[model samples]
Target: MSLVRKFATVASGTLMSRILGFAREMLMAAALGTGPVAGAFYAAFQFPNTFRRLFAEGAFNSAFVPLFAKEIEANGIDGARRFSEEVFGVLFSVLTVLTILMELAMPLLVRTIIAPGFASDPQKYELTVALATIMFPYLMCMSLAAMMAGMLNSLRRYFAAAIAPVFLNVILIAVLGHAWYTGADSLEVGYAMAWGVMAAGVVQLAIVWIAARRAGISIGFRRPRMTPNVKRLLWLALPAAITGGITQINTLIGTAIASGQDKAVPALAQADRFYQLPLGVVGIAVAIVLLPELARALKAGNDGEAASLQNRSVEFVLFLTLPATAALLVISEPIVRVLYERGAFTSDDTVLVSSILAVFGLGLPAFVLIKAFTPGYFAREDTKTPMVFAAISVAINITIALTLFPRMGAPGIAVASVVAGWANALMLLVVLIRRGHWGHDAPLMRRIPRLVLSSALMGAALYGGAVWLSPWLAPPASLLAQTGSLALLCAAGALVYFVLAFATGGADAGMVRRNVRRGSAAPAGTEE
Candidate 1:
C-alpha cells in the first residue's frame, strides 16, 4: 500500500485511541487532582508503562518484527508460525516469573526503581507501592499483547491491533466515571483505574488473538523450550533491551529528580500525556507500519525501494511533527487549563503542567524523528549502532537533568529530554549517512524550505489565535465556552497549516486527497 494510506489507517486508529486517552486523563484530573493521590497513581502507572515501552513497544517490536518478517518471507506460513509459538512460549514464562517477583518486591521496587517521589512521605510511598502491586501484573498481559500485535503486523492486519488501545482508554474512563458517580474516595477511583489497566491488557490481547485467528495464524503454546529460534530472539532481544533501557533510563532519572520536588512527577506525567498524543499518532504509527515493510524490502535486496521508503518516512515525519511542536508550545497553557483545571487541580497546578508542556514541546519533533530514524538500523539487524547512539543520548540526558533541575525545576528535566532527543536523532542520522543507508534526496532537499516556511506560518497563526482566545476562555469559564474555544483554536491552526502548506507547495494536496479517497485500498506494503 502507499505510505500515506498505510500511515492514515494506523494514524486514524491511533488518533481515536489518543482522544479517548485524553478523556480518561481529564476524568482522572477531576477525580484525583494533582495531589498526593495523583502523584501516587502516576508513579504506579509509570512502573507498568516503563516496562510496556521497554518490552512491548521498543525492544520486542524492534527485535521481533524484522526477524518475523524475514522468516515469513523465507520459510512460508508454517515456519513463521512455529517461530512465533516458540517465542511466545518463552516470553510468557519469563514475564510470568518477572511479574510474580515484581509483585512480591513491590515496596522495595517502588522505593528504589520507580517512585522516588514517595521517599520523603511514608504514607505516599506506601500508597504508591500498594497501587503498583495492584498494577504490576499488567506487564505480563501487555507483554503477551505485544507478541500478538507483532504477529498481526507480520500478517498485515494493522487495524485491529492499532484500535486495541482505544479499548483501554474506554475501559479506564468508564471505571473512573463509575467510581466518581458512586462517590467513591480518590483511593478507590485510583484502584479502579489500576484494575482497568489489567482488564484493558486482557481485552487488547483478545482483539489481536481474534485478528490472528482470522488471518489463519492462530498460535498455541507448548512447554517452554530453548530452541535455536528462541535463542536467536533472545540474543536479539538482549541488546535491544539494553538499548531500550538506555532510553528508559532518562525516564527513571526524571522520576528521581521530580520526586524531590512535590507534585513535579505527576505534573510532568500530565504534560507528557499531551506530548505523547502527536508522538503516538504520527511517530509510532509510522514506525509500526514502516518497519515490517522496510525489513521485507531489505531482505528482498530492494535497496532502492528501501532507500525511497526511508526518505519518505523522514519527510513524512518532519512535515507533520514540526508544526505539531509549534502548536503544543503555543497552546500548552489553555490546553492544560481547559482539560485539567478542575476539582483538586489548582491554577498553580495548571501553570506547572503548562510550563512542563512547553518545555516538552521543543523536543516533540526530535522524539518523533528518533522513532522514524531508528527503524532504518533495526530493519537491517544492526541494533548495535542505535544502541551506541542511545547510550550517548542517555548520558547527555543525565548530565543535563543534573545541571538543569536545580535551576529550572521540572521544566528543566523536560528541556534536558528534548536536548537528549536531538542528540540521539543527529547521531542516528550521521551514522546512517556514513553507512550509506540514507542520504539527501532531491525531493527532500527541495521540500525542506517550503516545509519550514509553512510550519513557521502555522506557528504564528496558532500562537496568535491562542492569545486572542485565552482571555475569553480564562477562569470562571463555563465548560462549553472553554471547550468551544479550544476546538475553534485547533481548527484555525489546522486550517492555517494545511492552506499554507498547499499554497506554498510544502505539502501535496492532491496526494492527500487521493489518499483519503483511496482509503483502505492502498497497498499494505511499501510501493516500489
Candidate 2:
C-alpha cells in the first residue's frame, strides 16, 4: 500500500476514536464537572493510562512490531504466529501478576506518585486511591490488547486495532450517561465511569483479538516459558520500557506538581485530551503503521526504499500536523468551552484549561514529529538512542516544572512539557541527520516555507475570528452558551485552516488525489 492510503486508513480509524474520546470527555465534564470528584476521576484515569502508554503502546508495540515483521519476512506466517503466541503467553502472565500487585499497592502508589493534589485534602487523596484501585486492572487487559494490536499492524491489518480505542470512549460515555439518566449522585456516577474504564479495556482487547483471529493470527495462552525469542523480546522490551518510564516521568512530575494546585491536574488532563486528538490521530497512527514497514524494508536491505518511506512519512506528518497545531492554538478556548464547560465546569475552569491547551498546542508539532522520527531508530533496532533522548527530555521537563511551578502553576507545567517536546524532537532530528538516516529531501524542503505561510494565514484568520466572535461566543457562566460558543470557534478554525491549506501549496491537492488513486489500485497486504 502507498503511504498515503496506509496513513488514511489509520488516520480515519483514529479520527473515529478521537471523536468518541471527545464525547466521553464531554459526558465526564457534564457528569462530574471540574471539582474534587472530577480531579479524582482524572487522576485515577491517568494512573492506568500512564502504564498503558508505558507497556502497551510505547514499549510493547515498539519492541514487538519490528521483531514480528522480521519473523514474518524470514520464516513466513507460521513462524510469526509462533513468535506471537510465545510473547502473548509471557505478556499475559506478567501483566496478570503486575495488575494484582498494582491493585493491592494502589493506595501507596497514589500517595507517592499521584499525591500532590490530594495533600491539602485527605478525602480527595483517598478517593483517588479508591478509584485508581478500581481502574488499575485495565493495564492487564490493555497490555494484551497492545500485543494483539502489534500483531495486526505487522500483518497490515490497521483498521480494527486503530478503531478499538473508540470502544473505550463509547463504553465510558454509555456508563456515565446511564448513571446520569438514573439520577445517580455525581460521585456515584464518577465511580461508575472508573469501573467503565476496566470494561472498556476488556472490550478493546476482545475487538483486537477478533481482528487478530480474522487475520489468521490466533493467540492463546500456552504454558508460560521463556523461549529464546521470548527472552529476546523481553531484552528489547526492557530498554523500551525504561524509555517509556523516563518519558512518563515528566507526566508524573506534572501530575505531582499539578496536584498541589486546585483543579490544575484536571485542567492539564482536559487540555491533553484536545492535544492528543491530533497526536493520536496522525502522530501515533503513522508511527504504528510505518514502523513495521520500515523495519521490513531495512531488514531486506532496501535502504533506498526505507529512505523514501521515511521521507514520505515525514511529509505526511508535516502536511497534517502543521495545520492541526495552528488550529488548536487558535481555537483552544472554544474547543475547551464547547466540550468541557458544563455542569460543574465553570467559566473559570474553561479559561484555565484553554490556556494550558494553547501551551500544549505550541508543542503539538514537536510531539507529533517525535512520533514520526522515533520509529527510524526503533526500526533499526536501536532503542537506546531514543531512550537517551527521552532521558534528556525528561530532565528538561523536570527542570521547567520545578523552576516554573512556583510562579505559573499548571500552565507553567504545560509549557515545560512543550519545551521538553521540542527539545526531544530537535535531539532526534539531529541524531537522525548525524547518522545519515534522515536528511532534508528537496520536496520536504520546498514545502516548508509554504507550509509555514499557510499555517500563519490560518492562525491569523482564527485569531481574528476569535476576537470578533468573543462577545457572542465568550464562554458564559451558563453551560448552553459555553457549549455553543465553543462549537462555533472550532467550526470557524476548521474552515479557515482547510481553506488556507488548500489555497497555499501547504496541501497539494493533485498529489493527494493521485496517491489515493494509486492506493486504490494496490492490493491489500502489498507493502510498498
Per-model CA lDDT versus the true structure:
0.82, 0.81
Q: Model 2, range 126-228, lDDT digits (tens) per residue?
A: 8899899999899898988998888888888888888888888888888977987899988898789889998999999999999888888877678789999
Q: Candidate 1 at 309: error in angstroms?
A: 0.6
Off by over 4 Å in 1: 242-248, 509-528
Note the residue pairs that clash in candidate 2: 116-259, 117-259
Best candidate per lDDT, number? 1
Q: Write the per-residue lDDT of candidate 1 for residues 86-173, one digit (tens) a residue.
A: 9888888989889888899888888887876578899899888888888878888877888878877766778887898899999999
TM-score of 1: 0.95
Once superposed on the true structure, which residue ranges of model 2 sit more than 4 Å away at CA? 242-248, 475-499, 502-504, 509-528
Report the backbone clash tally of model 2.
2
